[model samples]
Target chain A: MNALGNAFSLLAGGERETWWTIATSLRFSLWSTVFAVIPGVPLGAALFLGRFKGKRVAVAMVNAIMAVPTVVVGLFVYSFISRSGPLGSLNMLYAPAGVIAGQALLAFPLVTAMSYTGLQKLDPRYNETLLTLGARPWRRMIAIIREGRFVIVQAVLAGFGRVTGEVGVSMMLGGNIRWYTRTMTTTIALDAGKGEFERALSLGIVLLGVALSINFLSHLAVRDAR
Target chain B: MHADAVRNDAVRNDAVRNDAVRNAPAFSVSRLTFRYERKVAVSCDSLEIHRGETVAFTGSNGSGKTTMLKLLNGLLGPYDGRIDFLGLPLARNPLLRDRSVFVHQHPVLFSGTVKDNFEYALRLKRVRGAEAAKRIAMTVERFSIGPLLEREAGRLSGGETQRVAVARAVAAGADVILLDEPTSSMDSASGSAIRAFLLELRRSGTTLVFSTHDASLVLDLAGRSVRFESGRVVDEPSTGGTL
Candidate 1:
């Protein structure tokens, strides 16, 4: 208990390096969410609207991707970004950019799956009125998106939460480089490994605070969207 | 003028307009059929609607009255049949949709003001600038819904929403307005307002094809009444029909 109290002092001490790690983690998570949502929204909306063959198969594939372990995702991305791999020429290995890319990949499934489920629940009356009013094809699609926007925002929040909590992908692809790629999750793991239980516990508390903040903000947004 | 004199004046006016459309049916259908998977939704052997006609399709729920209105407005294509609209083959003509609008039974308002909803329809029909503004004002006045013009349209009462739906249809300059239970959601006052506006539309030569279970609406607005039962038109020869 004394050690935990000391850790709290260390955290509350406002050290510049610790704050930098916090900032870096948040920046990477934000970028990851931004990238995932771009392609994810259109892809998810199309998955709902497009009536081609293999639709069930495509949806199943998305659900399967959502179940994949984060460690496996890390390993798969590491292979491509490693020095001897095909994409190594870009020299992104052991960099924050690689972490962002890996985290974006992790968040993509959450964004897409939630969006698809959200739009699937839309009322059929929206489409019916638009079509009967002689709305052009593009206008009808835009109307559909607008109608499903609340669910889509929730999808985005879920992606943000997932990326912010992820440890495996950020640690593996980012290589935990000190003062550069070291993030909140990676520092927590490092502190625990070195038997620095106090720092680990304090950082875990910080992570918990951040996660709660995100969920609280999302709840407010959900109410507003409603 | 006396009420009977006004009725005779309308009849005479209809005759004069009929002369211009003497050769062509407003809509002609033969052996029309529609199916939803294994269930037949609509089936009719033959039907024709003359120009400037006001018709009502009356039946119980799921009796294919709404299905028939949808087929007429080209919102749903017939599984097997030929439909001629305004002297053109409906299947090949892309302009048929431009000439008609269907107000849904439960109207879904766009996410904006009442003015915006009416403007969207006018814009789609390529009416713009001063012309579009004029049309919007005309519709608002015609429906006596000037008070609801600035409010969020989706938050309106059921009757107000239907009024806006019909107004938007008119703003598009559609020659034919197909309404699927436009007044089923309204109170008596709102219903009478809708009927009066519909009569105003008829005077301007806009044909109205509506579906309703309201016997009074059919008696008041429709010159022809088509009755449906079990997904089939049971009215023929001696029953309700257009002459």
Candidate 2:
């Protein structure tokens, strides 16, 4: 009971760094989604719609990446961007950009795989109809993408949810610096580790709320697409 | 109006002359073959379609009628033979893409209103504003699609959707319209209405090539019947007369 009270009191104290952590996490997640979505949707559409020799291999790689662990992604990116690594000259370590890179990598495959599945499941006759209409290749692609916009939206939102709730990548890459790189996930881990349970619990609640809202919106988008 | 009438008569005379010339041997298909890997879809030795004609390609499932239609529209390239469209070898012509259009067995509707679907093809042809509006209205009214213009294509019934599909094809001004079992999903009323619509299209100087299993419907519409058995045209009539 005393531990619970202490945690509650800590939350009530309203640490300025906690708010900054939440803001940074959100900003990082937003950028990750933006970067990932721009290429992901087109990549997915091409994989599903295009006829090319290496298309099967590309699809297989994306499907494999869908299960990649966030911490592994962070570690892999960290090796290149760290002070003594190949890209060390860029000095990207312990920064939001590093976190964004990790999160973007993590989100990209999810968006792409889901979008590919969505487009693949569409009626084959749709493509035939477009061809019969004398629509050029690019115009046909644009029309199909427009028709499947709702499914694409859901895939992007799902990617956003995955990135925003992840802790391992942010902790490994962002270094959990106060007001600079600290994010909701990292702050929650840090506060919990330090026995500041109330602040951790508050941030946890906010994270769950974000996840629920994303899932709800995704559900709505899927329904709308139908 | 008189000039337009004279132009129309000239087109009709050309169609009649082409039809007569077709009787001497109109459609020339030589060593036509297609295959997807090891699976051979179509292997026609020879075939011909007359001008101003409605030809029906009938076959059981997987007999390659649909594939033949695709080949006619240049959607699929021939593995062997040459297909000649309007005295031009199909393989060597850029005008084939502009001249031919295909309609699938199932209508594919965009996520917009029916009017938008009509306008999409017109807009592609660079028709806009009053010119576009005038043609669209004429097409919609001709096909009795005015009530359906404001409705989303997704909400249309099967018959209504097919009607709109045919309307869109006509509005696109395709010289050779290929329909694959277009009336297969419609009720009798809708099917008859569609048949009537095709007759009107023929009168308006459009050449139609379609496939159907419904013998009665085929008898009513097709001037030439091409029967298929296992990926080849088994029997064909050379009457070249309107049904």
Candidate 3:
């Protein structure tokens, strides 16, 4: 009970460390979401529109990737970005860039798979109408993306939430350096291990709040879709 | 003597235009066959739709009326035979899409205002500026759809959606329209409105290939009727002109 009160007080008081941690988490999640969405949405649209050979296999591969653990994604990214690795000269290890890359990787398949599944539910007439109206391939893709905006919005929110709540990539790549790369999830992990429940609980409350907000927005998107 | 020369010149031009229309069919399909997975959806030995002809496709459900309409408009392909548009092969004909359009049984509008839908179709044809606006205005007034111009397309009723769909296609300069049951699932008022619209299109010399179960529609507007049964052309009489 006392720990919970202190946690809220810490948040209410706007402690510098807590606020900074929240900002770092949000910044990393936002950039990663942007990076993931840039290529993911189009790829998903292609998977939905194209009728080439092996399309089923490609879709299954994306779905499989979406289920992969975040820790595994972090480890995979670490291999290329670590010192003495192929991309070692770039020196991305234990850096914000490294964490952002890892998180983006984690969210890429999520965004793609979600967007594809969402678009699959669209009425078939939309595509036929676009084709009959003489919309070229690229233009058709843009139109479809616009038509499926509700589903795409949900996919984006899911990506942001996935990256923001994950501690594996941030801890592994960002090194959880205080005043540098410390994020809410990583900070909570460290403080909890040291029996410092106040900060951990505070960050947990914030994470819960974020999760609730995302869920609320996702619900609204679905209602709008119907 | 001057008036007599002008009359002769006009007669010569009409003969030339008629010859051109006869030589170039809107769609010439030969031995076309389309399959969905393992099931054949459409099989026709030979078919031709001429310019300014109103042809009706009469078939029961799953009888390939919709599929044939789609095939005519180049919406479905990789079939077993050849299809030509305007005497040119489908792939080589640059103007095929520009001159042809298809409307589904339950038409779907884009995710914006009816005005936006018009603009999108016109933009696809590269029609912009005052020309596009002029076309929209003319179509809106013609179809009595001015009240629907700013309404969200998804919020429209079935009849309104169909009107907007056909209007959008015509405004974009389609001379050949392949419609899949344009009047199905409509109230009497909506059906009458759509039938009136189709009559107007016929009067304007637009080529229309439509699927229908309504025999009265065929009797009223079709110059020629083709029947389909189990994906095969059971009967197709010789082509005739509505003119």
By DockQ, rank the candidates, best first.
3, 2, 1
**Residue A16 accuracy (lDDT) in model 1:** 78
Question: Interface RMSD for every prediction, one decimal?
Answer: 1.5, 1.5, 0.6
Per-residue lDDT, model 3, residue B195, is 91
Q: Cα deviation of B128 in candidate 3 (Å)?
A: 0.9
TM-score of each: 0.85, 0.85, 0.91
Candidate 2 at A148: error in angstroms?
1.2
Candidate closest to the true structure, highest DockQ = 3
Model 2, span A125-176: residue lDDT tens: 7777777677777777787778788878888998999999998899999999
Task: Report the poorest 10 consecutive residues by lDDT, candidate 2 chain B.
Answer: B19-28
Docking class of 1: acceptable
lDDT of 2 at A76: 94
Better of 2 and 3 by lDDT: 3
List the global CA lDDT of all models.
Answer: 0.81, 0.81, 0.89
Q: Model 3's lDDT to the true fold?
A: 0.89
RMSD (Å) per prediction: 8.3, 6.7, 6.8
